[model samples]
Target: MKILIVGTGGVGGYFGGRLAQAGHEVTFIARGKHREAIEKHGLDVKSINGNFSVTNISVTDKISDVPRPDLIIVSVKAWQVKDIAQQLKPVIGKETMVLPLQNGVLASDELKEFLPQQNVLSGLCRIISKIDGPGKINHLAVDPTIVFGECDNSKTDRVYALEKVFNDSGFKGRVAKDIQSDIWKKFISICVSAWLAVTRSTYGEVREQPETRKVMRDLFEEVTELAYKKGVNIEPDFVDKTMAFIDTFPPESTSSLTRDVWEGKPSELEYQNGSVVKLADEIGLDVPINRFIYYSLILMEEKAKKK
Candidate 1:
């Protein structure tokens, strides 16, 4: 399949590298030094699975340069959705399916608003990887699952074909019967984890400290309740399961928000934590922990800027 990856960050760079290495015709859309490095050397993926280097992949900064690919993977950060969706007009054709592996729940809707003619699929990627440097991605976990489906929940031939390509490439891909639920479940885990980690505390610290653990658990419950109010049938024991999962991760393991804190970079706090808080208020619900987290991260961002 001819695929175009819109954002060449860790998610895009790693998975797109995997597809390209498997001999699929993949084109990456990136800019700045990262794009330059990929065009000159190649996309590099450093993982426990083994290092992969693919030099034949095509890459460009301009969206106009991208052909009408059969599939497009929108892997950019959640905050870039609006502009990126608008910029995708020229390269997205009617038959093309755009799979967005973004955080939160509004990406597909935003994309559809921009490119109504194209098919926008809702997808969630479970991969612990990040752009370690320009043109370099660090894969930090064993899970490489992608759960997605069509907007209307119909089983289409195109969905099956895409699933085949994903599986054939050696990555775990499932066509979820309820992709919306999948997206919400991911958001629940992500919001809780990101909120806790944004405190500049390690996972071990958050898990071990009774007060911190309680706060984290409360936050998780709030998100789950809000998700239910929003019509997503998330698992009842989602919090317990997610907490147990986090306990097994490395003590030093942190989320993208925590990574941003450490590196003095901007975070998607508004889209992640801020989204939940805003929705809770609209629905006449109170989520104090989430609200606290959203504003706390804002203060951190401010401090970083002043420094």
Candidate 2:
């Protein structure tokens, strides 16, 4: 399959490398030092599963340089979806499938606003990875899974074909029964952990401390309420389930948001907690926990944007 990876950071680099390893034609869109490193030394992936490099593959800073792909995996930060969608217009063919593996639930919707609805897929990825260096990707944790489906959860040939592509590429890919619910399941865990982790606590510290744990539950409940209000089918015991999932994380684990904030880089704060607060407010629901998290860190977020 011909694939275009919109961002060659952790998620994009790891998965795109795997695809290229499987002999698929994969092009990566990267910038600055990362793009330079890939063009010179190839894209290197150091994974717990295995380490490999894909040299002589197409790497470019501009999306227009690539041909129309069969699939476009958007692995950029959730907050960048809107602008990325705009830039993708020229390369998006009628049959191109755009899969957004962003952190939050709003990415597909954001894409729909700019692109054709038929071209966007609701999706999320489960992988702990990042750019370890300019052209290097480190797969630190998780089995590297991508859960995706059509917007209405219908079974389609394209969905299954993509699943086959992932299977051949050496990763777990499942067509979700209900992609919206699956997305929320991911959102609940990531949103709760990210805000708490920003308080300079690791997963071990956040889960082990009583006061912090309570705050975690409160944050989970607020997002749950927001999910319910938004008509997403989150189960009643989802909070407990999500907490259990978090418990499975390695003790020192931190969310991407926390790491970005620590490095003084722009983050998905607006798309994560900030989106929750905004969505909840629109429906007359109070999400005090999310609101607090959003407001408290917003100043820092603003400062990061300036940098």
Candidate 3:
């Protein structure tokens, strides 16, 4: 299969490298120093699963040079999805399947704005990965799971085939019965953690303060309720289930947003908490907690950009 992986960050780089290791034809889209490093030295993945390198890679920043891919896996930050999707219009073929592995729930809808809905899959990845250096991906934690399915929750052959592709690459990939809800399940946790972590700079403080933990759990409840209101078939126990999951985050762990903020980088603040607040406003639902976090982070991000 000819696969195109956009934004060779932790999720894309690690998974794309695994696919290349499985002997599949993969093209990577990256820019700047990262692209230069890969062009010269190949992509390196340091995984707790196992470390490996893929050299002689097909990588370029130009979309015009890319072949019409059988699959396009988008791993950019949630905020970059729209522009990337528009840029992908040239390479998207009638048979191409686009999988969005970013955090937050807006990715598929954002892709749908530029590509056919049939071509977009509702997906999210479970992994802790990041660029340790130029052309280098570090998988710090998680078993590297990818849960995806058709946008309408159909059991299509394409989903099964993609699941096979993921499994063949030695990652835990599966089709979700309800992909939107699965996405919301991921959203509930990531939204809470990203906001609290971004605001407080560490989970250690929140983990210590009973009141902060309460606020954190409330944020999860807001998103879960919002998902239910939006007609996603989330589990009834989503809040409790998600809160338990949050307890397991490693002591030093922070959301990707927090990491990006610390590095003075642009983040998905708009797509994560910001999206939740925007949606709630449209539906006449109140999301004060999400609203507060979203606006607060926007200020922080602006300050970071000026530095």
Candidate 4:
């Protein structure tokens, strides 16, 4: 399969490297020193399962330079999806599939606003990985998995074909029965954990402390309530399930949002917590905790953008 990976950061670098290693035609859209390094010396992936390198692959900074691909995996931050979707217009063939593996639930929706609805697929990925260096990717934890499906949850041959591609590349893949609920499941857990971690507390600290833990629960409930109001059929006991999921995290674990905020870089505060607040306000729902989180970090977010 011919694949184009946009935003070759942690998620894109690792998965694209795997696909390239499997002998699929994979091209990466990257920028700055990362693009230069990948061009000079192939992309390297250091993983717990195994290590591999994707040498002699195409790497470009412009989407216009690449050929039309069978699939385009968008792995950029949530806030960048709209711009990337607009930039992808020239390459989206009639049968081309665009899958978004961003951190939040709004990526596919954002893509649909700019691209054809039939060409967009809702997707989410589970992996703890990052760009270790300019040309290298590090798979730090979790068995990498991708869950995706059609927008309306209908079974399609194209969806299964993509699943085959993922299975052949040596990672876990599943076609979601309910892609929206699956996306929300991930959103609820990540949204709560990320903001809590931003309070300068590790997973251990957040879960162990009574006050912080209570805040975490409130955040989860607020998000889940928003999901219900939006008509997503999430599990009733999802809050308890999310707590159980957090319990499995390593004590010192922190989210990508936490890391970005700590480094004073532009983060996904808008798409995560800010999205919840925006959606809730549209429906006249009061998401006080989420509103608080968004307002608290928005100034810092604006400052990072200035930098």
Candidate 5:
């Protein structure tokens, strides 16, 4: 399949590099030294499974330069997904599919608002990797996996084709029966974890204080409640399962949002805690814990944006 990887950061670069290694025609959309480095040397991925290089990578900041692709994998920050969705219009073909792997539940909706609903697929990526250099990506922990399906949850031919694509490329690719619910599951986890990271500092620190942990649990509960209210049927005990999952994270581990806040880099707060607050309001519910996180992250995001 001809693939265009927008925002070639760690997650994009790692998976894109693997696809290229598997000998699929791949193009990368990136900027500055990253794009230059990929065009000149190659996109490099260092992984525990294997290391490979895409020296002949097709890369350009301008989408018009590349051919219309069959699949477009959007790996940009959650806040940037809408803009990227708008930019995709020119390059989208009649049968093209846009899969957004942003770490939030609203990405498909954002894409649908710009592109035709048929062009946007319900999807999310499960990968712990990031760019280490201009054209280098480091795969840190999790085995890269992509979960995607039709928005309506139908087992269509296209969804089956995508599953085969990932399977052929030798990585995890799942076609979810309830893609919306699956997306919500991922969203709730991010909401809780990002809240903890933004407020308490680290996963370990969030676990250290009983009061902070309680707030973290409450955050999960609120998000889960919001999900159910909106018709996303997550498991009844999802909150407890998520809390147990959070406890398994290494103590020193901090969420990427927390790292961004600490380093004063741009973050996805607007779609995370902020989205929770917005959704809560839309649903006519109260999510005080998420509201607090949303406001706090907004302040940090503002300073980061200014710098």
Candidate 6:
């Protein structure tokens, strides 16, 4: 299948490179040093599973230069969605399926407003990956699963084809019947962990500090309540399962927001925690913890800028 990865950052770089290595026609849209590196030395994937280099990949800075693809993985940061979506118009065929692996919910709806012709699939990528340097992608662990489905859960041929491609490439990819609930489950768990981990020090810090761990659990519950109020049928033990999943995080493990803060890069706060709080307020629900973290991250971002 002809595929184009709109942003060659963490999620896009790792998954797109994997698909390319598996012999699919993949082109990476990047800019500046990252784009130059991929053009000159191919894409480097660094992971615990294994490491390999692919030099046969295609690279482009302009979307018009690429052909219309069968699938487009819109993996840019939340803040860059509008600009990137505009650029992606040239590469999106009528039947193209856009799977955005953003951190929080609302990506599909947000993109649909701009590109209404293409099919938008709600997706969640469970992994910690980042562009370590110009040419290398740092894939942190083995749980790099990609879950997605149509908004209405319709069994279309495109869904099955994409699933087959993902499964054939030796990655954990599944189509959820209830993608909305799956997105909420991930959002509730991740927002809490991202806030607590970045606020305290590290995942290790939260794991060791009983108080922080308890607070994290509380934040998860609050987020879950907000989700329920928003009309998602989350599992009763969803928060517990979320806490258990977070317990496996590596000691030094951190969120993309935390890393962005430390490295003076932009963070996706408005979508992750801030969006939850915003939605909760619209529904007349209280999400103090979520609000506090959202505001705290904004302050952290400002502080990082001054450094």
Per-model C-alpha RMSD: 1.9, 1.2, 1.8, 1.4, 1.8, 1.8
Sort by TM-score, best first.
2, 4, 6, 1, 3, 5
Residue clash pairs of candidate 3: none
Q: Positional deviation of 84 in candidate 3, in angstroms? A: 1.2
TM-scores of the candidates in the order shown: 0.94, 0.97, 0.94, 0.96, 0.93, 0.95
Q: After superposition on all CA atoms, how large is the RMSD of candidate 6? A: 1.8
Better of 3 and 4 by TM-score: 4
User: Which tens-of-lDDT digit does each residue in 154-249 have in candidate 6?
Assistant: 777778889999888757789988999998888887786456535657877886788888778888888899888888989899888877787787
Candidate 4 residue-wise lDDT, 1-307, digit = tens: 8899998988999999989999999999999999999999999999877988889999999998776899999999988998999999988899999999988888999999999999999999998788888999988777899999999999999999999999899888899999999999899888874565458777778999988898999999999999999999998999999998788777877777877887888998888998889999999999888888888888888999999
Better of 3 and 6 by TM-score: 6
Q: Each prediction's Cα lDDT score?
A: 0.84, 0.90, 0.86, 0.90, 0.85, 0.82
Once superposed on the true structure, which residue ranges of model 4 sit more than 4 Å away at CA? none
Write model 1 residue lDDT over 203-281, tens digit each, in one string: 7788888988888889889989999999888878889998898787678767776787667766667678889999999
lDDT by residue (tens digit), candidate 3, 1-307? 9999998988899999999989999999999999999999999999889999999999999866775899999998887889999899988899999999988887888899989888899899999888989999999777899999999899999999999999999898999998887888888888865555455556656766788788888898898889889998887887888777666666666767888866777787777888899999989999888888887778877876677
Better of 1 and 4 by TM-score: 4
Give the least accurate 10-residue stretch of model 4, judged by summed lDDT: 192-201
Question: Which ten contiguous residues of candidate 6 have the minimum total lDDT?
Answer: 192-201
